[model samples]
Target: MSSPRASHRGPATMFILVGFPGMEDSHFRLAFPLCFLFMVAVLGNCTVIYIIKVERSLHEPMYLFLCMLAAIDIMIALSTMPKMMAIFWFKSTNIAFDACLVQMFCIHSLSGMESTILLAMAFDRYIAICYPLSHSSILTTPRIAKIGLLAIIRGAALMGPLPIFIKRLPFCRSNILSHSYCLHQDVMKLACASIKVNVIYGLVVIIFAIGLDSLLISLSYFFILKAALGLTQEARVKALGTCISHICAVFLFYVPFIGLSMVHRFGKTHGSNIHTVMANVHLLVPPVLNPLVYGVKTKQIRHRMLRAFCRMKSC
Candidate 1:
């Protein structure tokens, strides 16, 4: 039998954000390192977006998709990091119910958008490498715009129902979330009522939306590999070289994801700190690393980023 719920509805209540369970005293120490990561994420992603926006030479499909990725990375960082820092630094754990839902929506939807952008990037590389002569005609500016629009819409539509479903649950059990920010799964776990709908819905979204995206990205890369194999060794190296940054970006995002999923499903004895560390790795590492990887690997972006830095120093 379920324990008696608190006699209040959930909407008006404030939920608590736990920075790290059993490690509350470590929050201040944790904040310093995490703050550095967040700063790098924000600055790196912003530089990528700014460089792409202003550089007409980077108006191609691949770079445009990269711009979308950078933007989504910034959004994800903004949605979670500030609140996380507040929790760690100021002990600001209480979040209004509505505000929590808003944060959840932003985090999940932006993650979905990021996943879609990654897939779009894979497709762009496939087209560029496999159908080099037709690349320009195939991925015109109009088509690229449409592709970006679809990513935004897909994210919004899929994650839109999450908050609504979560809102219907009675949250009388406990308000303490497992992480520093609001997540749909974390919030739903606090509810006294049945969360069957929310669980099934979240699973469906993860499978069809995020999961399918990764699958498609892999398929795109498979074709790209085949195309690359047909070329001479020198030509193959050049073609694959163009995808190095993207491959690194993909690994940064998904490898941690796979690791976290494994820990969640199989390592039940693991402490909450383990989960917290893994979750943050999945959530935070890509935003901090993708810009660096791309800027280092792509010569055009490297030159432009260096130029931008030189101008800033002169000012």
Candidate 2:
């Protein structure tokens, strides 16, 4: 009798989703909500981008990062959502090997870039809050431009090797991924060869890239909080209010991300559904909520967005 791996070897078996044991019924329930989320995420981020572009007053370091974030969300949603929707809607989850690698590259690269941009935004806030006298000099237009370019380069450099390495892995068995899209760990598990090196590399990348960035962001906020405490009560409240949205954005992205990683690493067999939910939230929540949080909290962006919307409606 042919092994399960060999049975799935032929091109004819590609995209054959051997789903989790009891997940067949759960797919429909999950699809509608996920589709609604994808639509909202795309439209929300796009509106932020449009408002920023049309309103010149909103052209500053903070809003620039917001635009970068919106762009990243668009790319990430494009990378994962359509394919996920197709799988759910049409039951046609066929993804070519090359396409899978490309998807992995785009998803991770954009995600990494967003993290880097957030770090830069944190630094921007730190300078603005802690060194108000020198904020202009410290975070000049040219400086922000350079930081954006660096974010792109850093994201590409860090994520470039992942797809290349994954492509080289001999996937002799189990092409059917449990998750919706091609995630690093999920794809690694499908490899027939030893994945010790890939796991190690992934850990190192996360530690140096995401881990280090998050650490620095936390440190920046630590100092920011300190600076805020020194100000008068009214000023402190104002400063904290300004940062609340960013704090929410940061928490939404990192907490779920860390939770997903921990669950996948330590609690995989026990709470796999919970892990799946967290992973989906990590990928979906920030994109859907970040713009809303920023727009509602930041007075200037909110005004600009409203004006843009009103003007469009009038036309």
Candidate 3:
């Protein structure tokens, strides 16, 4: 026989995602633009990946890193966007407990991977700018491959424990998640059991995975800028210009995320709708904008894109 506490716990089989809590009647209106953006994100990232694959000129370290970033963006989009659209368009908000945990794993782990790739890209830039003579040898093809592999491994190993820890806790509170996705903190709050360990581990993951990556990325940019200062004016302009898309990508991914987190923690006076919308924007904007930013800003990618478009039009 189960313990009294175990018997009193809420259903462990299902979780109801409270998607856009106040937009019960506007699902259709909301779905259109979100769906459109999702399509653009998908098509754009796919095009980037394809262009990089077929273009022999883009087989360098920087473009390889951009390709990796593009692939991660696709994973991020697929992981969250489909379910979000389902909730908005079909009212299919109920997710199995295991499924919710899986979603949590994918989103968080992939997010960590994306941040890691950004750090890697920044480091690549640093090495290219600060030590140009040794860039090719330092960031060799095999070495870049290893970096990509390590990034995935780091994300998975660190974030894999989250759902397992959450699974052990008995959720006596409501199973209704406030967001359209299964976020670590949101799901942890539903647990009736002691969550001190979970909370601590979650924070540690954030600090080590995201905080450390962001710090390293900042350090890289500092070195890159320091090196750029020693170059001629034209060279300095070119160096900084190369980083514009990446800078935009980092800003898009982190700023809204930090803003949403702050609002959740301190926005007691703010409406839940605010949190909901920010959460959606946080997930949506990066994938949608990263491709556009890169496609427009990166010369090689822009030229390749134009060539591909011309071919399509000719056919």
Candidate 4:
């Protein structure tokens, strides 16, 4: 009788995150830009959250959704950045299996939450533009809170089992993750056992989370566009203007994500550096850009930010 650990399909205890395959010598060079972007992301998202919290005027459904988006972006960034920085700057790329799974959970779950929030924002815009008189009644504070809670629960329920399933698989292949951070596909590739279950589950999660959210968001915008077309030019512009920030945020969130997915399933045999860089971009770019997009495009948030700056300077 052999020990359970002696079995070929037993669990792996740890994994090494390969920051970049052939770019190890340039880790120092990479750190400069990566660190700068990470700092910007952290500070930008913090500013967004603080402004939303402090400004009474921003307590509306639109701004509340923005607040939720910013928070999710922050969590997604924080989940991956420290470990990535460690890998790049200090060559400390090894991670415990459980820790890697936890990181994966944070990245995937928060990403799902962000997508859900984006959908909610789109719905907010739809109601405001298409049914102005009823917008207030439809998106009251209680309802908004419920939407947020449902987004969170949906993300958790979909992504929570991923790590557990991965943990059960024996990692006979190399424990080196292709990206600097933990991703479901990256981790799944290392398991020696048949990964059809993991692959199917991942695809299902993607279809339900990102796929469904994207469809609903797009549908909301379709109806929004239809309604806007019925109004005067000025009124149409006004209605469409409110959604510009959200539209940009959606692009920022989804484009890199789609790029990464395409490269993952199709470009694995391509330059490993390309894949790794895209993964980093997918994770880092959204958080840094979302707040900036909202801050610059949104008049209320921009004005409040400016006022806050002036008050701080005066003090």
TM-score of 2: 0.91
Q: Would you list the clashing residue pairs of candidate 4?
A: none
Q: Model 1, range 125-212, lDDT digits (tens) per residue? A: 9999999999999999999999999999999999999999987887666666667787787688778778899889988997898789
In Å, residue 202's CA in model 3 sits off its true spot by 1.0
Judging by TM-score, tell me the better candidate of 1 and 4. 4
Quickly count the clashes in candidate 1.
Answer: 0
Compared with the true structure, all predictions reach lDDT values of 0.86, 0.80, 0.86, 0.87
- Tell me the tens digit of each residue's lDDT in model 3 across 177-215: 778988887888778888999889987987888888889
Instruction: Please give each candidate's TM-score.
Output: 0.93, 0.91, 0.95, 0.95
Q: Which ranges of candidate 2 are over 4 A from the true structure?
A: 1-21, 26-29, 308-315
lDDT of each residue in 148-227, candidate 2, tens digit only: 89999999999998877777777667676766777777777777778888899889988999999999999999999999
Identify the leading candidate in terms of lDDT: 4
- List candidate 4 stretches off by more than 4 Å: 1-9
Estimate the overall C-alpha local distance difference test score of candidate 2.
0.80
By TM-score, the better pick of 2 and 4 is 4
Give the RMSD in angstroms, all C-alphas superposed, for model 3: 3.5
Clashes of each: 0, 0, 0, 0
